[model samples]
Target: MLVNQIDTRQGTNSTPEFSHGNTLPYTGIPFGMNYFIPQTTFDNTSWSFSPMSHQFAGIKITHQPSPWIGDFSDFIVSAITGDIDLKADVTNQMGSYRPDAATFNPHYLSIYDQRYETKTQVAPTTYGALLKYTFDEINPKIIIHIPKNGSFILNENKNEIKLLIKNYDSHFNDDFKSYASLKFSNKFISTLITHQDNPKYDSMILSFNNIDELLIRLATSFISYDQAHFALKRLTNLNFESAKKTAQETWQYYLDLISVSDYNTIKMSTFYHCLYRTFLFPQRCFELDSNNNPIHYDLYNDKVKKGYLYMNNGFWDTSKTVYPLFAILIPKEYHQMLLGFYNSYLESGYLPKWLAPDERGMMPGTLIDAVIADAAIKGILTKSEIRNFLKAMLKSANQESHDTRLGRMGMKDFNNYGYLPSDKYSESVNQTLDYAYSDFCISQVAKLLYEDKIAQKYSHSALNYQNLFDPKTGLMRPKDSSGNFKSDFNAIRWGTDYTEGSSWQNSFSVYHDINGLKKLYQNPNFIQTLLKLSNQKPAFKVGGYGFQIHEMTEMVAIDFGQIAISNQPSFHLPYLFEYTDHPEYTELLIKQLVNQFDDTMNGFPGDEDNGSMSAWFIFSCLGFYPVCPGSDEYVFGIPIFNKATIHLPNGKQFNIKTNRNCPQNQFVQKRMLNDQPLKSRSLKYVQIINGGNLDTELCLLPYSKENIELPFSLSN
Candidate 1:
């Protein structure tokens, strides 16, 4: 099965000095609440699980979507033999393990601790994990380190351990809490829960004797200990192999959705791993009850609510490709996730921008509007529910929440000045452009719901990006409150008014109105501007970032000019060439990017950021991309493989075949969808979901841009 082929550590080999892709070696089911990973190092704070590290701290139960967001509700479990050292904490009590020799996969993990002479194997379930420890020595022991500020109690009669964790790094207003129940096969010879003078670092250590082998079953919950026990009972019967098989089967069910047949094994493997990453986020936080009803703990209300809830997703990273990819392969889950997002809105009174457990309000704009509109436009949601979705979209667009972190940062400023002022917010230019795109999304949803008046208003408001576009530089420059462009403009300077990117990367982000943006500098100049962006050196001036940020480092690491395909801001850049006279340049750039990724420790170009980068790879390899979500059209690109067969949700298959498909023959010559020629370099969303064959002729020579229909634009 394809699931067995995935390494899960494809992009996690990173360090403070250099980062390839800051991904975790997560072993779990798709969208599982808890991911099991070997904590390679306890050094450098949040940068714990490094693929290159030789030391094994323990196996961690992590809900960390990204290192930037940090992990919460996380705990470490380690097995040891011989004499016990009570004074040794997690940092001091580490063992050396060969990272190269360790077994790492999506379903199971096995690591040999050289110091303790113990071999540990871990298998994952949705809410819990099964751990088997085999020690070479007579005295076998286990240590469980709960996060600081968390409490745990061990029951001798029930042979169960219950834990509650309240420690989160940068959290929202919610009283973030996590519960867990751990069951062991052997009797606990001795157990101690101790508090140190530090108070911040406390642990529960359990010791077992005579037994060389022990089995540990664990379950986690966000609601209560009862919920945790409920989860533990559901999976208590599962053994290591059984649990691994179950998790593998769950992953195979999703991985089988898209099958690629290519002569290149490594490339195909990379594609499958990227495909795997796309499904591992926006985890279902709700658990099934005795009646099999989904229920989740609502943090806002401080109560357990009976419904579906999803967390650990940031819309800023996922809105571009992840949701669109789901709309294609897993529409049913997509619908449920949309419902889950709506549930988040119902609880928090606003749609979330970033969520670990609740609203983090990171990034810019309410981009969930884009996800909703994309779903609505694709007709994924039922007619009965479109109104509710539209209401949520409008609420985000119009109603300003009292907390700036909950809604748009500068909603009132955008409404009053038509754009956010540079002085008010850090990334005002990004906020303005993102808000404009989201407004367009809101308008699309409103249109779908037959709210014509609402649609028209948002449609006009969507053009707010025009206010920030400086005609002189032909870039979306930051502007002051008095309507003057920020005087000092350097396109390659990173951050101030832009979010994690320079003006060169952020300017052409008017995905909704590409043609309108092109008109600001005329078509020819627009083409020249795009050429300059691609042809220029990848050099950057730190600007607001006094030192080099990781983004700057990533861009410079690759020789892809100013097109930082490593980040989401530059994701649509390759597609932007279609708006110009050089459509083949877009194809060439995409091929360059698609080549950068492979099934290795350095698989991704940058931080996967909850599958955004993975989704980019999946879409690019499939030969089309959703450049603008909320719009039905998918912009065309060069396909990497010979053939790709997508399993659509309606029991149909959408097949893409490429002829003369080789490394050198990278450019497309002709394209046909369902045996009919497509004049445009794009496909409708309906065409893909309805299921059909798309055949393309590719050769060594680039296709001529002349007389070719361009990708969809607002002016078109």
Candidate 2:
């Protein structure tokens, strides 16, 4: 939502400001900024803030405190006592591997403390992680003089080392900028490394206020263990100068991978976070130690027998949205990401789940199938090696495609039966829908390379879900093995037939291709039958698409209480209306959903899968969404942010001019290609790919236009 028609950021020429995510801060967003941390949540792990001088501004993550290593000591002890090999059991130890019930009580927390005081319960974000956990800038160096000269042993984790400094005499008066300089009676590193580490899932930019804050953070985070500075012992054999050079080079190299031309803040933060999230997985294994070569994996990995590179907590779920969006926004890296998946498959015999350094043990489903196949077709992964993996993808899809325990038990005999077999883990209408969608993706990859027979085979498998769509109720629902509608379940219940929380959700789950789905209803009688579902009420014991469910949105259940739209499984549900006569209704629905679920503060409806969940918001606000990953297209939806400039990776900038209207004027009126009249609810893939800008004219029209063909993006 824009206020007074002002952009949240007015390009890069303005002063850099930041917002405390946990509290209301007048400061704008910080970019290329380094935030100082006075505390961290990785429990009991010792750390301190000491940033290099030239790293500019930064901030810290301050909101809810998180469960730290200190919080997990008992768990660690158990893992170790149980002889849990650090490498092999790293995922479990990381707290990411647990029964769904186990994770309900814990949270992922990263934040600085007591920096900015505010009225909100969320935080007083004063500083960042003390050790200045970054070194990506040129001449990135920090001089830490132990107050009273303390003896400290620095501990290195998956990426960087940390420590605390205090009680130094040569101090600056309360002059703000002077606080950034270090006063040392004892020699620290003599030289320091210039980069820091962040998980692959966040933005590398730290948000901060001033040099003094960064220094004050270094000055007060922790007490000295013994006075004698650990630096006197460690720099005995370090090539700090070359390391600094390498760090600068790494920054430039990463920058080279994508373009940043939009509202610099949005593009940089968004792009950096996308890149940062990658760090969360395929763990960073090799670092330049004076001479560059792979060191044994980091302490966390070494302890867990995991490698240096970790892909982190998110996987195929985001690959559907984030990874595929990157295919167009940042194609080269996405290509590399595909290869990384391929290689992980080769080393591990299956596509790594979250890839927490390529661990295929977490999460359900072989989701990589959709991403890989999509990437191969879009030319993002044009290598023959990828072609080989496509074959592996097929095998993986066939062997591990879990079609809800019930869908496979002779349930395909629809019309004759009204319900699924009354077994514990089946109905599987939802699972079957996704499986069919995945099959469609597989078929697309086969088709792109002219593998006609392979494509034909998958095409049939992909359509298998059509058998589940019930004509009487128009719901993608369950049927008995004899094809009769299930008597025990209501069409509005979300849990009985699909993933997460319903048919309202599953009915719209077909993301691979939309036209095929529309064809399913082309027979007028079939379309009318499905209309009854729109008015169905929630049949669940209790639930609403709210922040509690996470993917904040308006969730309506069909089949009693089986589908909840506020969860990831149902995140893409609302747009299903775009495939009907009520396209504008779908457009209005998205705006209402955004208002209900997101704001500038907590921008998502639920636990954002890495950035997969947030990616939906980002792109939708830009007037579209990447519903089907790897398709090189975005389905038309609604734009929340009044105007957004998408900096293309191709060094061009495109702006989503949201001129149509607000929640009231939610329909697309007349679209234009530059100045010429256009007739689609969506734009062209070639236009976005080749750096074309989109400008839309909107009106609060009661009816949607039928003249233009909606690109495949908004199909289903």
Candidate 3:
């Protein structure tokens, strides 16, 4: 079974200073409202859990997408046996557990506490989870670790506890709270609520006298206590085994969407592991009422709103791969997500950039425009929806918001000067480049709705990237408001004008018009420049950040030259080679890049960023990538698998077959779609979803001649 093959710990071996994937071993349904992970530490920080740690703190229900973002509405559930101080710190109560012996599955989690002499397991549902505890001795007790500003009521008569937690990192209302209900199968002999001076370690303990085993059903809601109880009531009829089966079935349904036939067990495992990460983000933020209507807590207005809402994703990362993959495999969910994002626009004045629970707005540009435009071009959204989203896009592009998190930064300067002035804002070069690509996305949406004037206007704005092109350095440099490039420009310096990258990495971010980017260079020609970027020494200066960031460390660790696959800004760099005469370089680079990933705790090269890097691997393994999300084409690479099949949402199958498909055969000699010669080295969105066969012949040697039928470019 695919679910069995997945180790939830794949990418959990990480710390705040260095990351392997910077991911947690999340055990829950795909895109579940809450995920339950085995917490190994009691640190009041984002690095709360690590697979390498032997300490068994508890099972924590977390809404933490990235460690940098922190967690919201989170709490821990643990089982204990011997005498332990209730008011003591969480680390004091933690027991030793063998990390190697623990089960870390998507649908379930299991760990044996050696000190407590108890075994704990959890099976998660959409809104709730079923927990089982088996004790080796009497006096089995359960501990609930509540965060600060949390209160709970124990109803001994009903064998249940009601909890209210008020916690968030940022971008939440004062009234933002999570209500949860915990229903126990066994009656507790005694219950005690302990308060600590340090609010982070507050606890409640429930002791069962004679019972050797117990079952706990827990449910939570952001709406109200009634809704939380309702969610718990839905789980009342199911046992641990039944709930586990349901969770497994739910995950299997999504995991089975793409089937790969490869004899290499390790490679196949890595593919599935990466695939598992792809569906874990943009989690459901809305819940169904008694009438089965979707409703959500609106952080913008602090009111209960009616609609399907999703959260915990940053469009800056996901716009590159996740949504585009959804366009091909899960259009229904993608369409619903579009409505949800549109509803966010209706609630908040602008569209979301990064939504942990609400818009934390952590990245550059309102890149959701790319996601919406990709869906619009693929016919995944209605005309009315497209028009509504286009208005929101234009609002963000043209207007500045009072809250910098809501819309594009330096919007007034960007609109007036054609680029974000370096003097006005930090990371101005990235802001300018991202805004230009977003402008192109807006143009695509406008063209879909047949608004030619709007399309043309945004298309013109899209070329604003060219404003920062410094011909002497052959890189995109920052420009000041005085219409001059910034002096003392250094291409190898990190994060003064760029976003998490140096000019060497962020320069070629012209996703909508790579050929146009190539036109800016003369002596080096874009091809030679790309060669230098790939072969240059992997050295960097901590320019703006002053200290070395993890991204810089990760890039040097992999030694992939300026192409920092460790971060999203460099995701499309390798694929850019496809537009030049040397397409074989792209195939070779993709093959080498994918080797950095595996099916272990340290599975990824760096922070996966809510499945952006995972989707990158998924696409690269399939021999293609959505380099430009707003564009409807996927640039080709060499397939890693011998055979693979995509079960399209429209009840069709898209098959991919690679001949001489091995690690050694990394270059494509010939390509065919449905048995016809495919010379363009690209595939259209329609062609993929409509279902056909893509056959490629790969070899060790490069193709002698250039295949010039390149992908979509504004200049073309």
Candidate 4:
């Protein structure tokens, strides 16, 4: 029921091309390897499914993580009637469709082509898809088009087609082969295949005299065509409707895990939509063999291996909120994912920072350290597994990777100089802050494993952020190798010593040691500091980046001074108010943010990169947030819903009830945890999993006079 309410297109519509929510209306299972979308353009661009586009190119099988990262092993499937456009480009061959009359959901997508009077629907399995079509006229046809550098063959049997695609978009290798097996329902009168002069764009069109309906079952694999067929054998017997129902049921299971009761329909829809986005990443990259043994293609080794693996995620964004959500809602799957990540480490010799098919050392810091530490703290991995995890983590922190493309960059410099210098890496400020948090994560895991010597070493290393902080300016400016802070610093500048952000956004990212970070501020007036960030004019000086990046534009659009909630670094900015004298200021800011998002196409403040932004909204709407991953704590915020129930993994229910809850009633007057008076503005991980009722009374005025405990801090 909840799946039916989700549009699946909430964040696909962007203000610029890829500024806010560079997301597609993806249709697949929770962790499906392949996501299905109606490709509206034939340009083969990363953004193929714009919500406003009326053209129907085909149903694309994509493994695109983000537009900035590009796509791999992608191809298109389309249904047409009466005509063959062998030479037509995407626009010339495209059929107009009404966006309003289309069906878009997590499990299914349907579009009616106004030009041909054809309705196309598609449903997905973990590694395959079932596409059905209905035509209003006679002489129907099906087209399977592969993008640049592709070739395919139509088996003379007329029912089965074997396809192969060569894509070189990955960073791990110059090129890789992807295979697919497609089975059609009707006997084709004739099959005509075409190859453009450039040899990049190739297609096969199957013609039928007349068919009211048709079904196309497709299975894809990066390994071989036989494996692709092996993946689809189990689903070949299921009808179109049955496949649709099965996919819908699979999605409903996850969507029903958390239930919300509110009179406001838009807010409820927004909550469920955000919740839906959180489970769509880290897709399953491994498939089971004949004996149900897991096997995957090892890009690092350039061979197939027997092991479960996962890909298509960046830890920089996900470490903040995604993994913490999984620890609470789906710990079993989380455990499996950890094992998968461990496999990546075993193959590549280091944990991945960003993976799409393979390691793409993007973003700052090897943030998987936070993921591993959080899983260990939650007891998700076994004793032996944790030990292995610790070994891989230690190696990453200490050793220099064989390839500069893997592991933490400038590791030797950081170890020797105590901080990565601006001359060494472009994002030195972000590197210092990110690695500091990662050091704290390593310390947490070491402490859990009784490795006190290692724990103390990394714990001390976590304070490296202090070396970059300038108390006078209250910013973490980049430093040179000689231990001197770099001059000519502008706080509003974007991407000089920071990653897609300025010093202000990356300054307070010592989530593991907030108190240590706060002490670096001379004024210690965090409330005013946050206010300064929120009230400043939306001005920026493109520092290292000569022109304005999309992040700068998004931050200016949000107009929250310099606080760029448009990106991940500023996610915890609003909650920082709790550290100051006035905790209620956070409540107002949280309310403003939650109200900004809705259940429409252009719903997010910025790119919901791999569900980080969505997870932020989900946690805030539930009245808590995992501000720091390995800390095992969630900072309290204002709840948007009146009542909500969480189906905890331990079979107990965690309920949150708010009295007189509304947009106006943003402040909490009093709170009770399990009928006991609560004074803290935070909740522990144990309290949430143990499952109990948390009730709060709301008021129009701030509860400023009350003495409330601050969120979990290292000093406290």
Clashes of each: 0, 128, 0, 1
User: Better model by lDDT, 3 or 4?
Assistant: 3
Model 1 over residues 1-716: C-alpha lDDT tens digits? Answer: 36767888898877654567888889988988888889876543567787777988789889888888888888888887777666755577788899878888888899999999999999899889899999887677787776667787888663678888877754444467889999998887787776644324567778876887888899999888898999999986688889988888888889899989999888888888888889899887988898999899888878888889999999988999999999898888889888888889998888888988788788888898889888988888898778897887778767888887787766778899999999777889999999999989888887877788988998899999999887777788888899888887888888888988899999988889898888889544888888888889999999897888888888899888889988899999999887766788877888878888988888877888899999999999999999999899999988888999998878999999999988887688889989998788789999998899999999788767687787777767
TM-score each candidate.
Answer: 0.97, 0.60, 0.99, 0.97
Model 3, residue 412: C-alpha shift (Å)? 1.9
Candidate 3 structure quality by residue, lDDT tens digits, 1-716: 37977898888888877889999889998889999998887777898887778998888999999999999899999899977777676678888899889889999899999999999999999998999999997678898887776888878485899998887645547678889999999888888887655436568889888688899999999999999999999998999999999999989999999999887888889888888899999899999999999999888888898999998999999999999999998899999888888878888888999988888989898899999999999999888988888899988777778889898878778889999899989999999999999999999999988999999999999999999997777899998889999999788999979999899989999999998888899877788889999999889999999998989899999999999999999999999889988888999999999889999988989999999999999999999999899888999988999999999988999999999987888889898899998878789999999999999998888876464598989999
lDDT of each: 0.85, 0.41, 0.89, 0.85
RMSD of 2: 14.3
Runs with alpha carbons beyond 4 Å of true place in candidate 4: 15-18, 197-199, 705-707
Comparing 1 with 2 on lDDT, the higher-scoring candidate is 1
Weakest 10 consecutive residues, lDDT, candidate 1? 193-202
Give the Cα-based TM-score of candidate 1 against the true structure. Answer: 0.97
Please provide, for model 2 over 265-374, each residue's C-alpha lDDT reduced to its tens digit, 9 standing for 90 to 100. Answer: 44334433333322222222222222332222222222212112223334546765666566656676566556555555554445555543324243334566777766
Candidates ranked by lDDT, best first? 3, 1, 4, 2
Candidate number with the higher lDDT (2 or 4): 4
